[model samples]
Target: MDIRPTDRPDRRTFAIISHPDAGKTTLTEKLLLFGGAIRAAGEVKARGAARRARSDWMKIEQQRGISVTSSVMTFERDGLTFNLLDTPGHEDFSEDTYRTLTAVDSAVMVIDAARGIEAQTRKLFEVCRMRSVPIITFVNKVDREGREPFALLDEIADQLALDVSPMNWPIGMGGQFEGLYDLEHDRLMRPAADNARGFEGDVEQLGGMDDAKLATLISSQGLALLREEAELAQAGYAPFDDTAYRHGDLTPVYFGSALKDFGVAELIDALARFAPSPRPQPADPAPISPDDANVTGFIFKVQANMNPMHRDRVAFMRLCSGKFRRGMKLNQMGTGKAIAVHSPILFFAREREVADEAFPGDIIGIPNHGTLRVGDTLTDGPPVTITGLPNFAPEILRRVALKDPTKTKQLRKALDDLAEEGIIQVFYPSIGGQWIVGVVGQLQLEVLISRLEVEYKVDAVLEPSPWDTARWISAATPEELKAFTDLHRGALAEDRDGAPVFMARDTWELGYVSDRNRAIRFSATKERN
Candidate 1:
């Protein structure tokens, strides 16, 4: 593959994270807009006031206003290329965030100035810290109601225990909100004057608050607000003493309403200026030796849609270390399948693909290559192993018993394929123990059901979820086992009604018996004729 350096593209990878409804998606949309990925910025709820998340693509996701999966995009600004990983803010998909965090270099923790630090924000911040990923906090929604920027900044520092320093402070929050006091520039950049299309004269000289407030700041408040234009003219960036707030060195805070397009250009500028790129760092670390080593990439995720014709996936991959070109003979790490690279390019969501050969530290997509799976490393020649991704066993469990037992075999095969694609588990427990399935969340379960009935032409029975034995366990008593067996036998004797009734009663009995220190053998129970 032929490759050329694009004028020192800053090797910075950043993930946008925050609690649900904290404007993470809004911030992402604004960033994408400024990066020229999308010509126009779309609202989260453009459909008759129904909020639509740009990153969320699932039907269930559009119906519900929450992000269930991670959406990644890449853009370039000022010769710096950024791999922007946008993650779900909900706690249910926290594992997804954890997995995506491994591929990124830094994080942009988007927080609502009004709501401050939330439970999910705290949990996610802890995850970033555990990985030692540097962060730049953006106090978003300054134009929203009940915002208190300073208070929220303090809360972030206290609650999340972050070394957060405000590089920009909001002039006034909520309705009266105008712009920010750029600590580095000492200029007040505010909202546009309604008619202004882009970054116009929205920013004006504030004269450093009123005289009374200035005196109050000096005597009672913390730092003195610089004396406007004169201060900005003197120092280009923040002072050397203000090394505490330099880009790349410390957490630089910015404020604006992403929805209103306020302070977005400045945010993009900050991202390009402050965020570090992937250059100079040992991008490819797979091969033990340097000489004659082929390029290797690690697959972080796989995206699949239901419609057969539109069955395309973008594998979020990191060039572990090696050079790869178009049509390169790439082999999966453990598999012998030699898959040819179609068009190697950086992916800005599925809609945007830039023509460029990806190198170390670059996140790109491999199209139409079905052989690669998550955690599989693809190399041009001999296999080289990199560190494995963090292991997260699926927690949510469910089961579906086929209604037409005649189609059980077909259902099992279809569900198995679904399981592989969905990163879920499907299995039949014993000879006729129904089918036990596992997924990451409830939405996934619904998708599985839909695929079964719609895609596979299998009419399946979704039985009520059984109580997890691990959660409610106790020693099994003979009497309890006998009661359970009696119930099961009665249900079997009664046929269809008997099975459901007996299954329900048996489940309850197991719970009661186990709670009272007893175990029942349900998996090996005899089927009464």
Candidate 2:
């Protein structure tokens, strides 16, 4: 509860991750609404979809109705500062989501009650599990017809391999829907009017589930079924374990319909109570603790043009140590230059306001021209590079063909900016004037084209590249690398950072080439050295 530079604050920095069409956007809207960051749900700039998540700010995301960019939002409730990171739900953006997960303390996994533990959900869960990031499951769409609560919980336990504990149980699901029984608080929450999407409007105070007044609201059959299921869920699943949950061994599940806003309030409270403050971050030489008496933060993401009017670039820095005051020059470890951040920002209603000061577990955007980069660490004390941030190998590769020759400079500028955002990779061939572009997924290409048309006013088409995939080439000595590059000059290219890369037609060819050159290493991932 202390607000000093050395004292730790009540911070809950977490992300919401789910598969596509799992009511992820709706849940985000309600969380912001309950946190009082937004005045109304309708306050989000609505386009054709009408209810897209405000975090889906990019034009391509709105058009495709799938979140591809990670959006960071900061808010507070009950004197606890909450940094809610909305990660990309689509599988194409899994790489971005993976990096975003590194910045959070925990994650809320949203599952469709009717369709439990989806493919994308499972993948994201594994990433969380790998880092020991705690998870809280929300079974969404309970108001609609869906699977039984017990079956859903079992599926999660089996698929995720984590102990399942029910924080709240649904009375009846789908058409038979009644409401949720607060297992922890021992109360009843009935459904609201048809127009309202949540259950906060009508709640009944009760001593416990066995209170005599329960018979007034429920039919005998429904009551019996509710009691039977609730009892089994409690007895069968693992009991709530904060220590296990934080260590990623157990998950506390809650049932609700984000569309109906059923259990969002409880979810927020769970985060405030159970979710952790800033934890020690992995770094070279040593790990950085939250209580360290130094300003330390890493740039996990960079946005090229968040505002169309200003056409500015903002580096999203997760405050990992010390309290940050505006105008303080922190050393950018990437270039050994001091960056005096004048306007650090927080997100709300799609607007930016200068952050005068920020503490650990807070995400503030530092606006800069181009001095900062993704994976760069800034600190006021001894410099240490943050670890685990890396660029992935692109699955889809192509050559850019400018539709108008006069716009060559514009296309180059556009590619550079988008590349810095980490959505795409630019490769300059050693022997040709044509530039190659690569991305982890196809949607990233669409986003690049859309941003170019809207933001940079350039037109281009993607043509098939000679290579199917590429790898970063490294050798024990410069002579070995040069000999390989000189022999395969036609297949050699340079990445955005000017790292040598060997382009291959396919995985089979890549293997053949690597086998032939025993001294060269073709790596799929390019990590910071």
lDDT (tens digit, per residue) of candidate 1 on 101-153? 76776788888877888898888888877656677777777776755555675
Compare the candidates by TM-score and give the number of the best one: 2
Model 2 residue pairs with clashes: 197-260, 197-261, 198-260
lDDT score for residue 3 of model 2: 52
Q: What lDDT does model 2 reach?
A: 0.87
Report the error of model 1 at residue 486, Å: 26
Per-model C-alpha RMSD: 9.8, 2.8
Q: Give the per-residue Cα lDDT of candidate 2 at 204.
A: 80
TM-score of decoy 2:
0.96
Please name the candidate that would achieve the greatest lDDT relative to the true structure: 2
For each candidate, what is the lDDT? 0.59, 0.87
Candidate 2 C-alpha lDDT tens digits along 149-259: 889998999988989999998888888888888888887888865655457667787787688788897777778987888888888888899899989999999999888
